[model samples]
Target: MLTLGPERWGGGVIFDPAGYALTVSYVLLDAEIIQVALRDGRRVPATLIGLDLEPGLGVIKLEGEGPWPAAPLGDSSGVAVGDTTATVGVDADNDLVVAQGSVREVRSFAGYWEYMIDRAFIVAPYNPAFGGSPLVNVRGEVIGITSLRLGDRPVVNLAIPIEYFTATKDELISRGRVMSRRPRPWIGVYVFPGDHGVVVGGVSPVGPARQAGFRRGDTIVRINGEQVGSPEEFYRRLWQTPFGEEITLVVLRESRLHVLKVRSADRYRFFRTTGKPPE
Candidate 1:
């Protein structure tokens, strides 16, 4: 398993009267214990409630009963490019930090780790404390949750639109996942854009891809005979197929074409959803 580290820190928003907090899912992955710090300097222990991997969102319930301030949820669909926005998060000192910026772009975003968001926000002037930060509109309503910092010279933050949450919030809180949606097939390969096409960077040690003879530097050309030009296309094609199905991958390695077959599986099967580490 890949270790993110012993300790992780990120911002989150309390968006429920019952102390349910929303944040990026990566932070809570394999977490044995969670602690939430409020602006008033109160550090309260929290418990993992659920995770929605599709949009990369997670929810945690803050311990204790009394009055939690819930941020008003806003409609992200109305958010437009060039609209004023603020990225709000807490620094290491637990002090509120806000970065003023505007929506640079609102479009689809794809990551190399088999993740994609159809409607995402690209906010400018990159917030250093972006992980789990709340992107607020002019009305001070939370419109999105900042997930990652993209680009180099002119960095921008990618915010997952709030609409994704509002649509399935109840399902996540009740079942720890959306039961209505079918699980996407996961091969566990890390791929990036290459000169000719998508190239395999590495494979998960426990994922089916590793056992299927996939190697680093293998340029992927097709999935089941369908051409894949980019990482986004690769993910879309892969997810369209049901889990546990045999997947055919054609790759160019060392100037020779090789055909590899792998049976994909549900990613949750390998992930630890409980607060306790696997015993």
Candidate 2:
């Protein structure tokens, strides 16, 4: 259980037998104290190992003994758009809740709360109660981790593919995160796709964009001289630039294009060293 003052939440599957656990970073965000509850009802303390924001994965080291039951990782690349699966997680009562489902689509999910998830697996018939729930296949192998719950006819859920964990597992284990010499550039603006260009809808209170005099309703036309046609393109282009680098941003404000230079900072760096993580 992760406790931030009085709040508590569950985490992800244990892929390591020696007490290492994998979870989303948001689960441990601003957490003052964290505990790992075992199947035998022993709630022990857990420490933050590392987190990578680019792919959005968190790792933790639970204080426990050896020979734990770990989930088998499945090849998410083989998951199809119609594959049937199941989601298992803890509910509000801390009771186990499991539901069956199938993949509805595989696409890039973006422009919501400044969250960008590429190759997100949208599954139907299962509504996730919390993050870090395992999306398992018929063979009991984990294909993805349930990250979001949206819509409800039969209750659709979103999960991050398991491959993201495997790809960054070693880096997180050793360095506590993706150790890059250069961090990704972040201006801290939440934008959406518009007919003309990428439109800024929300600005982070302490982000570079807000500090640099960016405003809401400003449509972004170009970044670092390249045109941004969509929200995804804008984010992709931003990630391509190095963190802490100065870049040119051309925006259409009041039907006129204005060029502004912004000094970007590392997003993960800002979140880790500063206050609570961005919502």
Reference-based lDDT, each prediction: 0.90, 0.77
Which 10 consecutive positions of candidate 2 have the poorest summed lDDT? Answer: 270-279
Writing each residue's lDDT as its tens digit, candidate 1 over 179-252 gives 79898899889899987679998888778898999998999999988999999999989998877999998999
Candidate with best lDDT? 1
User: Per-residue CA lDDT of candidate 2, range 185-217, in tens?
Assistant: 788887988888889897877678888888999
What's the lDDT for residue 264 in model 1?
A: 91
What's the CA RMSD for each of the models?
A: 1.8, 4.0
User: What's the lDDT for candidate 2?
Assistant: 0.77
- In candidate 2, position 240 carries an lDDT of 84
Clashing pairs in 1: none
Listed in order, each prediction's TM-score against the native is 0.95, 0.86
Model 1 TM-score (2 dp): 0.95
* The candidate that achieves the highest TM-score relative to the unseen native structure: 1
